[model samples]
Target: MPVAAVALVAGAVGAGPVIAAVQGDPALPERTAEQLLADAVRAARSDPRPMSGTLMQTSSFGIPGLPQVSGAGGSSPGALLAGSHELKVWYGGADRIRLALPGRMSETDLVVDGDRVWLWESGTNTATRITAGREDLAGHGRAPGDRAAEALPTAATPQQIAREVLERADADTAISVTGDEKVAGRDAYQLTLAPKDEASLVREIRLALDGETLVPLRIQVYAEGSAEPAFEVGFTTVTFSPPAPENFAFTPPPGAKVQEKALADLVPGPVGGQEKGEELADGAEVVGEGWTAVAVLPFSEKDLRGLASQKGQGAGSADAGAAEAAVESLLKSAERVDGAWGGGRIVRTKLVSALLTDDGRLLVGAVTPERLVEVAGQK
Candidate 1:
């Protein structure tokens, strides 16, 4: 299984033992920071064993007046940015995986079975099928519904988050072995990474690596001057047993609206046409490196409206209106600021700063507002 194929899963039967393990601290031999870091990197790159587990993610960014749009429940993409969420995952390999986000009365599932991928939303009775060609299967080629899959809250996982943080680790990052810790009732070693730059809003990031397998079981990211984690994702219960073959089989619910998409449709055409990948590459650029890096992208009002409309379709008109209103409230709450680069509105949260320029450029990063303005001036 590829590293990207690795994610967390859930079952009450599997949760019992894990819950018992969390009660007492497990004793383990001490290891150096370098040893633990190397083990984590190796595990991430290596083929992972078949597993199933449940993951929980919590966020406390402290963005005031955050809207609670109707229909945006635990399965909604917007819900991932705030509050708490639980996800169940089953990973057989890179070619077979299932992620389920259970809501009070509805459930959303993303299943990749061989070359066919299915996204099922019980709330809306919608099923989207993405067919990947043999050539595209290895890389998981993008299709029209790729954006919809990207919106799934299951996209965030402990292994995924740990991989990204490890990629950003450099000389500017101070790495150390904090101590041994328990996660999901498993003995693990805790590794901490702290950025050297003062301008970055991130104070430190911590990862709990399983003792034997070295798979990341939990990750916590803290903002500068804050003791609580701004964002966190971790497995609560896990098992190494392979999921049943039946778990990968899916037949959309009867009467559900189904849409089919092909990879060829994602290809660009002639006459100034471009694919989504190319458009994003050409329109966005990253400034700086490591912790203080800022991403600059072109985002106009039209684009925002399109996003709102897309959310509305998945949800409903009333919820869509609330979404639009939320966007308006966010813009209104932003402070007007003028910099040497230009004038625009800036929004600051505990761990993120975003500047929407008058010229329709959006610069965002986990850095100080001053850092965002500095990067905007460079543009």
Candidate 2:
């Protein structure tokens, strides 16, 4: 099977101990990281393997300012995207894994034999041809072993993942060995793995195992350097069994574009000659023509309303009527004002629509720049 196929199964199973090994004492002699991982692999391999199931996956990122973005800071940053796949995997000496991503987007399939690889999505409006050789895939890099392999530790093995707690759990990193959890209603062990070091590559991982089957219910990944987790995934179902032979091959369509780009070339450097007006705060550089953009930190609608309301708050009874009229007029004017923090300026002419983020910041895109600068600089 191709490495990628294995990754899908791993995603569902968490890592290692495929078959239920006799549950040693909850507090048995802690094994080394290597040993624990090996057991996991053994358990996983020795099983009435899963035949087919759906695997749901999600990936996100941890950026300084772009907290909600997915993947690395420089990678794709869609706030949230989800995907699922119909998966079939067979694990023996050499495993075979297959994935049919949800949706009719594409029907690409990957197969692996030792290091040799085969990929077939669709070709001739039916099945595609095969390129049989490790050399054919050399430039592409190693194929993924399973879904979890990509989602789990940066470079983790079933053995390593199985005993992730035994190796990394420390005072700062508290590893929780839960009594038992359930995946697909199967009794599973819930192992909560956390990082002892703040700077560790992984922040935390939750492993759910089927106690009877010795398979994983789910595995979750979090921010690489945060106390709070940013993303999680769970397998609704899992089975260990072989798939149809056709699942391993790929055939491109007659006129399919076979363009391939190196990973290094995918990086986005500073885009020049263009001003990108996204979510700019205090120190974002102003961009564009006939305008300057400024961000008002700690600014709120209530504060603006309060300012307008103050027009009548200090008036005597006789003057109260005039003060109230003035306050109403000021509030009306404030409502008409609008702004946006993009196109290199905070348009402060008229209000279009106001955006409120999860964080207590208001994204007010306006229509005029001069007034925007003034508003941003307000005390």
Candidate 3:
């Protein structure tokens, strides 16, 4: 199974109720770091199971003057960058899943059942239906349900996050079994991974794996020199019982605007309609690897200004306005700097740094400003 598929399965299993015996730090035989890592990998490849739970995500990047919006409009990028969010999830094997994000006065739902997928936003009374391709339905590649999972506005589940982190583990990373711990009232083993490169802004990543199932129950990311976690996502409640089949069923209300899409429409093509194996159409790519990786994107100053001033003319305009104001404020507050790479604006936070170059590129990563500059100079 793919790593993401494993994450889905593991996340589903992690939703189950904890046994009474493992409520606290239950005594168990000590396992080496290697042993624990192997166990996690094996568990991820196991068959999917039924599970349901509530997931909580929080972030404190220490970005100065960043707006923290909540309530019904919290799904915006600015809102998700800060504050807290709660999501309810249900999983029944690979082809069935449901995720609901509730707000003060509205709710958003993503439901996937076999080859059909639905995204419904109550605030706007809009429904989007995506038909899965044959490959997705056959489970030969990325599934529509997985795409739905990625479409989540908030951070992914602990299992998914852990899978991404583990995939980047290599010689540059130092992995260890920190100790026994409990997460969401379940007994767990705490695993920690720290980057050896000093240039990486990440201090360490901690994952709590269920002792019984080896599924990730919680993930915490700490920035360099920070004692507290900069970001965290974990389950607050879990139950192993299968979700009702009706949860995956969705129907657009009367008078609701319905939009249809196909799975192929979501896939990105090569640059300038080039054939496969050509450059990316977006003129974007990742530089470096592992913890030191930096993302290079084609972004001009005009684009930045346009994004800051953009406004929505229809439904959800309030949220769009708020997001625009936040972006405008962030741009106004950004510091201008001239370096060997060229003159540009830089935004630095406790956990991440971004440099928008004068030459129409944006270099960003969870590394230091120096790393961004280094990557920019290479271009």
Top TM-score hit: 1
State the number of backbone clashes in model 2: 57
**What are the runs in model 2 whose C-alpha is more than 4 Å off?**
1-51, 62-95, 113-117, 122-173, 199-203, 222-229, 244-246, 249-379
lDDT of 2 by residue, 1-379 (tens): 0011112221211121212223333433344433434454567545335355554444332111111222211111111221222332333323354444323343434444444333443421233222323332232333323321221122222322343333333455455555434555465565665645332334556666555554555565553444333333445555555666655444455666554332222222211111234444453333222111223345444654565456335444643454345434433433332335322212121111133222233433212334333343342
How do these models rank on lDDT, best leading?
1, 3, 2
lDDT string for model 3 (195-241, tens) is: 89998888888888877778788877777887666676777787777
Listed in order, each prediction's TM-score against the native is 0.84, 0.40, 0.83
TM-score of 1: 0.84
What Cα-based lDDT does every candidate model obtain?
0.69, 0.37, 0.67
Candidate achieving higher lDDT, 1 or 2: 1
Could you list the CA RMSD of all candidates, in the order they appear?
6.2, 18.4, 5.9
Runs in model 1 lying further than 4 Å from the true structure: 1-26, 68-72, 140-154, 263-280
Kindly report the root-mean-square deviation of model 3 from the true structure over all alpha carbons: 5.9
Query: TM-score ranking from best to worst?
Result: 1, 3, 2
Structural RMSD, model 1: 6.2
Residue 88 in candidate 2, Cα distance off native in Å: 6.0
Which portions of model 3 show Cα errors greater than 4 Å? Answer: 1-24, 45-47, 69-79, 136-140, 153-155, 254-257, 263-281, 308-317
